[model samples]
Structure formats: C-alpha cells, structure tokens
Target: MTKSATKIYILDTNILLHEPFAFLNFEEHDVFIPMTVLEELDAIKDRKKDVSRDARIAIRALEDALVDATPEQIAEGVDMSQYTADHGSTGKLAIYPDHLLNQKNLTLPGPENDNRIINAALHLQREKKPREVVLVTKDINMRLKAKGAGMNKVEDYRTDQLISDIKYLSTGYVEIDGSFWDKVTNCESKTEGRDAVHSVERSLFTQPVFINQYIFDSSHSFAGKVVAHDESKVELADIGYERLMGREAWGISPKNIHQAMALDALLDTSIDLVLLTGPAGSGKTLLALAAALEMIVEKGIYEKIIVTRNTPEIAESIGFLPGTEEEKMAPWLGAINDSLDFLHKHDECRDSSMKYIMEKANIQFKSVNFMRGRSIQNSIVILDECQNMTSSQLKTIITRAGEGTKLICCGNLAQIDSNYLSPLTSGLTYIVERFKDFEGSATIHIAGVMRSKLASFAEKNL
Candidate 1:
C-alpha cells in the first residue's frame, strides 16, 4: 500500500475568523479560497464590534500577502506576511497553501451564486480528480451539503479545540504509589514545577479515585515526567479566617493543587490583580470571594471587599436607578450574596463576622458605573461578569485600584451576555491579553464544573 497524494482543501470565510491559522492546521496540501470568501470579509470590514472587526483585519492581512503574487507562487500558496517581532524584525509567517496550485484542477464558481463556495469545491473536485477534495467548514448545513453531494471527504475545522486530544487534555491528574502518597501527606511540595498538580486536585475533589499508585500529569505535555511525592511536603490547610479588630479572612479552603495555585495567585502580594476565566460553574466568583475573605479577615491586608459587575443597560449611567447608590446596588449585589451564602455554610461566625468585616473594610456593592468616582484603597475588589464589559469599562475598573488594593476579575468568556462581545474581543480577553506579560498580573482558567452534572452537560452539549 502507498500513501495517496495530498488532498485539495477548500475553506469557507468563517474558517479564517474562527481560526486564523486554519490553513496551517492541515498537512502540506493544495488549499483553495473561493472569491466569495473575500467578498464576505470585505462587507464586515467596518464592524465596530471587536471580534468581527478583528476578523476583517485578519482577512485584509491575508489579502495583502497574496496580492499580485506570480501564478506559480499563487499555485504554491504563499503565507501571509510575517508579523513583526518585539525586536522589530519581520519574522516570516507560514501561510497555508504553501505549495503552488496546479491550475488544471482549479474551479471558479459564478460570482452571484450564494452557494458558490460549495459549488466551487465540487467543481474543483470533479476537475482535479485528486486523491480527494475535502470541504472544511464550521457550518453544519454546509457540511451536510458536501456529504449530500457525495463528497465523503469533509471535516469540521478543529482549530478551536487547540488541544490535540480532548480526553488527555482534561484537568491534569496525577497518581502515585501509597509510599509516595505518604510523602505527599507529609510535606508542602511544588510537584517539581508542575502545573498538572492543579488538574489532579480537581479530579480528587469531585471524583472518586484510588489513592494508590497511578499515572500523574506532572506538566502540560506528554513529555512531562512523573515524580514521586513526599507527604511531609504536601501542606493541606483550611483558608477561611475570622475578622479580628478590622482584619481580613479567607472564604474557601484549598484542598487540591488547582485551588492551591488559585489561592497563591490570588494572595500573591506582588500581584496587584488576578483574572479567572472559564465556562460557567467553574467556581470563579467563589474563589475570588474566598481569597478576599482571607485577605480582609485573616490577614487584614485590606479594609473591605468591594464587589461589582456590569449590569445590562445599566453601565452607561446609574442616575436613573430607583434608589440611593446602596439601594441601587442591591440588584447587582445578589451575586455577592450568593457567594456569601456558600461561605457561611463552611465557616463558624461566618455570617456576623462577614457583615462586620464588610462594614469594617468599607466593603460595598456598586454597579460598574458607580465605580467611576471612587478610588479603591486597601481593598480586595472583585469584578464579576467581566465578559459583559467593554475595553473602556475594563480600563476604568483596572485604574481604580489604589494603594494596598487588589482586584480579581471573573467571568465566562464562552457565555458573553453583551451583544458587542465575542470570545476574543470581550473585556476579559482584552484584560488578559494586555496584562499577560505583566508580573503584577496573573490569569488562571478553572477547568472543573462544580455546579452539577446537569448544568455541566448543558454547558458542554446544549
């Protein structure tokens, strides 16, 4: 048996925006982009929304690289021009369709045909007579059309699922011998610079697994090596604390590596702010409150916990709110109350102490609009529902941090309530991307779904 020649891959317009480097994901092959794709991209160039506009930008970038190239080079698809490096040097980009096209197999659909993309793919397949012609798309309807047309070679672009193997990409896990387990029980260990320890903790928290010897994810890659554990080095401690004479406290306990890392990021004095992002039921708000309680009640680092989120249609102004600032905030405060109820169940005197701590720390709830006039000082501030925030809104919240203050931003990037935001251009993404290189900031993506099985299923499938 012999390997067949590379198949011709045809892409739709959405593919470029959904995954910019989509062309590169496929192996060396001939790739075709119908003229219809370019026309669609052009119509949205002036979109004010971030993601849509960004897509237009990417399409232009690709067009610029391909403009006026020689026929041979066009046949051997050229990469978009390389992006500039930090050093200002142009690093060449590996554009897909690297190989020149064999024009004999080319197909040009009618300009006005709505299904020109699919029609072009079919026409090309008939002419090319290559080993295969694969129609790739995110649209289910398009995929069905290709199949109905008897084109068996079709696939959905899996670029969004960056992880090669979803099964293996699940929360990192580790298994060790009973002997090593004893060691983990004995000491505060770092898993030898491993982040996989976080995944193991999630598994340990919600799932039932033997404590005996097994495989553990020591790092993010398969190449990461396994190591023995030391009990004396594994430190397990409850995180909640009582307020003492205007002090701080921790709300949630850290029982596993994920929570432990989350706590460390939240509590790091050098880190002025932390951002937690994930799908719903990922414990983002709960963890932020837990850390805020610890800082205000246990350590007295801040005076209060000021929590707020961008409420729908209420961001532009709070002047129309029916009550005083505090009264107006009640609606937004409901989310904070939910987290508080969770904490109260776990800690003694958690109710009165929480109230006392809130008053002592000057903790108050406000809509994002009300936050404009105040400078948060020595306070642990949490901004939830951040996906609903715009770039300007995020800048305001980040700038409000005064001396001795810390901010934790939480939201689901996948569940944006704001019409203007998509996964990539939301305030959460802007903040994360902007602060990624800053030492004073950190981002942690919570993986486990702690809310319930039904909710998790809905999130994953519904």
Candidate 2:
C-alpha cells in the first residue's frame, strides 16, 4: 500500500488497558490517541489494578516519547521507533485534540466517551480524506457504534490472537482404528514393566499427531500414549485403561479417556506444562488439584502447590477485599474447596486426614495481581480460570515459573467471562497453540461432562 493509502488506527482506551504497547503494533501506519482517552486514562491511572497500572504505563510512555519534542511535533506525530526497537513496525504516534462534531446530523445514540472517540475518528477521516481511518477497539459495542456512525473501516485488536478459530484447537487425544493395534503388533516390540511397547508406521493416520498425545483404539479396547514420531514410524507406549484408572491420585480416578490423558500428563515429570480446556463440569479443576495433591503430598515431586487465577472482574480491583492475601483469595477459590471436598469424601478421610493433607500438601493461594518479579521453583503452579486472562497477563504468569516447576493451566473456552476476551483470543487458547509443538508441553480438551447427568444435560441443552 502507498503512504497516503496506509491505514491509520485510532486506538480505544480498552485497547491500551488491555495491552499497554498496542500503539507499536501498527507498522508504518499512524496511531492516534484521542485526548478524551488520555483523560479517561488519567482518571484511572492511580487505581490499584491492572488497568490502572497499564494506564500509568501508557501515559509514562507517551510522556517519555514526547520529552524534547515541541507541540508542533506532538501534533504532527512522533516516530515510535525512537522509543522502542522496531518489531516490524514503523508507526508514528500522535495525540489528537478532542474535536466537536455535529452530533445532531450523526446517528450516535448518545454523547458517551465511546461516541466521542468515534466522532474523533470521523473528524480525522474527514481531515485526511482517502487516508483510511480505522477504529481499533476491543469492545464489540464500540465497533458497532463506529459502523453506525458511517465509518467504513473498523477492526478488533488481533495482534495477540494465537488462533483464528476455536475449532482448530487441540483436543489432546485421537482415536486409532482397530487396524492400528494389528499393525503395531506386527512391528518390533519391547517390554517395559507390565506394558508392551511397539513402533508402527506413521502413515496409519491421515494427519500428523503430536508428541505426548494419547491414542485409543475403541474397537480393540486398547489405549496407548505417543512417545516419539518421525517420518517413517511412531513409537507407542501401551497405556491400559485398567492401569490408568486403577492408579488413584488423591482418591480420584479417570472418568473418561480425556481425563485419563490429563492425569497421565499431570503425573509425568517430563512434561512441564499442561493445558486443559473443557466445559464447566468436565473435571478439569478436580483432576488438576488431585494430581497436584498426589504429587506434592504423596509422590514428593514438588515442594508446594501454588494456585492463582485472573480475578473474575474485567476491571478487577482487590483493594475492597479485607484480610490477608489467602483470606482475600478464599472467595474466588470455591472450585478448589469443592475439589478438596470431593477428594476428601472419596478417600473416606476423617477431619484429621484432611488437616494432614492440607498441612502436608503446602498449598498456597497467591494472587495473580502480585505474581510479577518472583521466581517460583520446584512447585506445582495451577492457574485456574485462565480463559479470563489476556495473552499478555498469561505470558507474565508463565514466565515466572522457575526451575523444576510444573505449570498447569485450566479453563473452559466456551465460558469466558472477560468482556475483552473471546475463545479465539483468550490466553488459554494462545498457550495451547503456542506450546502444542513444544517438547515438554501438552494440551488436552475434555469433551465429556462427568459432574452429573443433570449438569451434562444443562451444558448441552440449557
């Protein structure tokens, strides 16, 4: 595209709050931040929350970028490359003054902040004729309002999206035909303890399979886990249902093939990261907690279990809550308590046993707000309800894992609660796609709901 034809992206406040460095995403195109947006950012910059922190960061970045520049230079726009290294972006950043538009002639519903931003875009479009002005926002309503106001170009902020569609996500397991066992039995064999292993032709499947993915042969009632694969052959390790289901972790057994695969990944020390996606009643949290308890209390793998999650509110502020960190987190940890209850009931443990388990397991509830700048080592870190998190927040939490730490992220894409996040753009989806091919990472999608028959019916029909 030519210079005049290059699109200009007018960023919404939520875009900056969702990601502080969003201006750098537009390559060679101009990025405009309305003065109204700056006012909103200034209003919330001092709040004790992530969005406030981001607002402060955005303001500071702009100030630092415009340090020695003149008012004319600010209006004309400043080169973003001077502030940060180019990540394939040559965008110029500018702060546009609030423009008063004839709202009587426009179709805006009201004179809200969003309408003001749209009016500013409209003003820019009128000024820079033929230079496409697009409103980039994370809010669906803002995009609609922009279109209603006669702006032709509008788009979601998709710079961090890992997958375009949710259907392409990994289900973590594949069903093999009955012929798979027959072909495997014909190939070279080896014995490992009570399980038999073999190397079979890679052409058995029409598509490529991932490493550490579970394989099941429903026709022959055979189950196996993929150990290795190459162009010619795939190494399979027999994982009998009897063996997997019989092995109880904190008195919880696998209710389905997907749960079994999840447990296998959870128990294996070789795999350092596990991603589980499913519906509400799919036992994702229960299985993760059980495995963490078994590993921490029974197997002695990790020193402690650190549980954290993105606070439920889209604009979460923890200042209102009272008491210590764990006490404040207790309200959000209902799922963990429910899982503990089930484990206690299933194991037929008395109060003493529950107390012992709680004390010995060394469970710690850390807030996601305070997870930065700390290195967690030799711990089983569980990030629950991760679908609510943005890709950037998830990256921050994941990078905090130190040596010998196993990170298990659990979330349901169908039940995202964050207004700025969707199934395709969620952090859970981001990690699933980014780490699916990695050697020490595994992603599983549990299809069945084992909570109850009523819950299953509600999930499907209601």
What is the TM-score (0 to 1) of candidate 1? 0.52
List, residue by residue over 1-462, the lDDT tens digit for candidate 1: 122466677887777765555555554465677666766767766654334654666686565656666757665555433322122222122223312334354343234433566666777677668457888886777788667766668787754343344232222223333333333322232442424331223222232221111232233112111122232222222111111111222535553345444556677677787878777887778778877777776777778888888877633456677877767777766767887777776667778866775676566777776677678788888898898876667888899999988999888877887654456556677676566545577666676677789888988898
Score every model by TM-score. 0.52, 0.89
lDDT of 2 by residue, 319-378 (tens): 578988887887888899888877887455566666777789888888898899999999
Candidate 1 Cα deviation (angstroms), residue 369: 15
Give the C-alpha miss distance for residue 205 in model 2, angstroms. 4.0
For model 1, give the 10-residue run with minimal summed lDDT. 238-247
Candidate 2 residues lying further than 4 Å off, grouped into runs, are: 81-83, 100-111, 181-208, 220-222, 226-246, 314-323, 346-349
Error of 2 at 286 (Å): 1.4
